[model samples]
Target chain A: MAEEVENFEPKIVAFLCNWCSYAGADLAGIGRYQYPPNVRVIRVPCSGRVDPLYILKALQNGADGVLVSGCHPGDCHYIEGNYYARRKFAVLKNLLEALGLEEGRVQFSWVSAAEGERFSQVIREVTESVKKLGPARRMVKSFEIPKEIEKEIAEA
Target chain B: MDIQSEIQKIAARLLKNKEVAMVIGYGAGSAPNRTAPVFIDKEKDVGKLVFNRFCVNNLSLYLPRLKEKGKIAIVAKPCDVRTIVCLIQEKQIERDKVHIISFACPGLLEKDGKTLFASCAECAVTLPPVYDTLSGEAKEMERNEPFTDRVADFFSKMPAERWEMFKAEMEKCIRCYACRNACPMCYCEECFVERSLPRWIGEGSEVTDTMIFHIVRAIHTAGRCGECGACARACPMDVNLAPLAKQIREDMLNLFHHQAGVDPNAPAALETFKPDDYNDFIK
Candidate 1:
């Protein structure tokens, strides 16, 4: 288990808002910033579009960590989109914590299109925290072959 | 006259005058200690409407579905009326189309008729927040310790242990969705769980699937839950869902300073946000 933990490469899913965090990530790539290659980014039209279900689905589907990034307060291209997202994430975060998800498992951040370096720094912080927590076991779905199927395979 | 007679008289008058097309209220259940919702449309049938401790179901759950039946009257406990106000706020039902007949609730009892339900023990709203015609003067019941205080030890445990505790409770869920059907806030015509296109979670009662269903349901009903304990009562397996409901209620109250179903005009917690809403959790 210790060796497994040592070799663990956490799979993190990052939902980046198209106008801001996605562009910021592009800048990070162009600037060649050195950050962990752990996160798999999915661009969304707005951070407000990140349903709490998406985060839970990702976690249930075996994501070690999830990050949601959007425009800084008062800078959402759609005006108050991020503002609504802030309230939603706040409630969702509290609910997740209440259900025993670690504080760092799901994270929220504001990264304007211009803050490319900050986006890289956020990724590093999220990756480091997730690495310390190891692989998530709770809420991760598992599939087991039916007993009948297993017996058939054995007979075959 | 007792509150029951008063309610019947008012209901009869409403029906006699055609003030409402139907009155949705509780009737005698199959057993002595139970009550089932009954729809009455005739003045003479107003005798079927009864109010007692066993009338625990949140009758407001029928409001959204009953819209096509024309104007309706409902018997509401303080908690039930909150869901009514919530439905009106959500625009699921028109405020004017429904008449609320609320009484000063003598909190509901368990099946044994000895103990109060946990929700009534912590009875927060003694009076209906919005009522068209109230029947009796609501009496304040002695407050039990807050639900949060009851779960403080669970919260103090490590995250993994807490998850185990919550998962144990969720494992009892058979995915019958009795709780969902009992909830007035869950008015989505096609719930996300039923959507095959995205297939949000597995269909059967896998532990993870059960956990996610309860988790997402709690999240979906976050700001809107009335803490009415309807869902808990509806669970045939007797899974204790009070903790998740209470936690979300506490967060909604503490974080947003909002209590749902109280003021119909107040902006919904998730739908509207102040420019300076709490976001310290964000980095």
Candidate 2:
């Protein structure tokens, strides 16, 4: 079990805004940039569209790490969507940190459509940080019956 | 004159003139040392209105529900008035329809009447930000301490210990949703929690679900919470919800220098953003 635990691979969920970060990831793929295979991408219309609930839901569903990326500060497809998103993200990040989650478990970054290399670099960094932290235990919901309850059921 | 008789006189005058269709104020609850919201439609019942240390309910929570009833006259503390400002800014209620009778709150007492609710103890705004009439002379009180001290202390604990504290709090939540119901800003016709087509959150008091519920609720009310302490007061389990809400308020002030309900004309912090809002956390 110890040997198996040493080989643990992290699962990461990345929420990328459709106009920029998603395009950047696509460009990374088209450019054949090598990056970690840990992240599963979900494209949203805007970074502002990613409710904090989505991040919490990903964590609650047992993802080891979550990343949210969007257009650069002044470059949102919508005039000021990323600007609004930046504020929400700051508040959410602070609240989550205060709630006691490990720092690197959730990340925020700017990845424009032109920066394919930066996208891969962020993925590499996020994967390595989450791997160092190991699997998330806090905020992960367990559906399995309690051991005592299982024992009682067996006796009954 | 005592504040209670003053409140009764004002309520009677409002009812007598038919200036308001109804006046929402506090009355004695069935239990000792408790107060309940009373909706007085008749002038005679103005005598039932009371104000004291026990009037802890943030009556603005009822504004959205009562807006359709008629033009309303509400008794508001400084904190409750903040919620009213939020409600109006959110377009949940119109500014012109309701008459606000606000007072200078001398901090609320706990059931014991000695200790103050955490929100009230550190309250800086004792006078309402907006009111149609004044109930009493605005009292001068010094705000010496930041209200987030306790929350900041909790945040300083180890990660494992903090998680334990959060889990313990979640375990005590019975999903009564009194917190959501009591919040003036949570006036959605269809809350995300109730949506079934694409159920956003699971309906359970399980630890993770409760945590999600709270986190989502806190984020939703992030810049808008008036710090009225109504949610904490309404909780039968005493769930220490102030810290979570206070954390958002602190972040708003720190990041945007914006305080909710302080300026009715300014856009909410989350709804509008500055070009150079803080983003040191972003890569």
DockQ for all models, in order?
Answer: 0.76, 0.74
Tens-place lDDT per residue, model 1, A54-153, is 9989999999999999999999999999999998898888888887888899999999888889999999999988988889888689877899998998
Model 1: CA > 4 A from native? A145-156, B143-153
Q: What TM-score does each prediction get for chain A alone?
A: 0.91, 0.89
B1-283 in candidate 2: lDDT tens per residue?
A: 8778888888888889988899999998898788999999999998889888899898988888889988899998889999999999999999988899888888787787666778887678988888998877877655443233456667778988887888888899999999999888988989888889888777888889899898889998988988888898889998877668878988989888889999999888899888988988998
Residue A151 CA error for candidate 1 (Å)?
14
Which digits, one per residue and each the tens of the lDDT, describe model 1 over residues B152-224?
5567888788888888888899999999999989889999889999899889999988888888898888778
lDDT, candidate 1, equals 0.88
State which candidate has the highest DockQ: 1
Quality of candidate 2 docking, DockQ: 0.74
Per-residue lDDT tens digits of candidate 2, residues A1-156? 445446778899999999999999999999999999999999999998998989999999999999999999999999798999898889888888888788888899999999899999989999988888888889798988999998998994
In candidate 2 the C-alpha lDDT for residue A13 amounts to 94
Give candidate 2's error at residue A20 in angstroms: 1.5
Residue pairs in collision within model 1? B104-B138
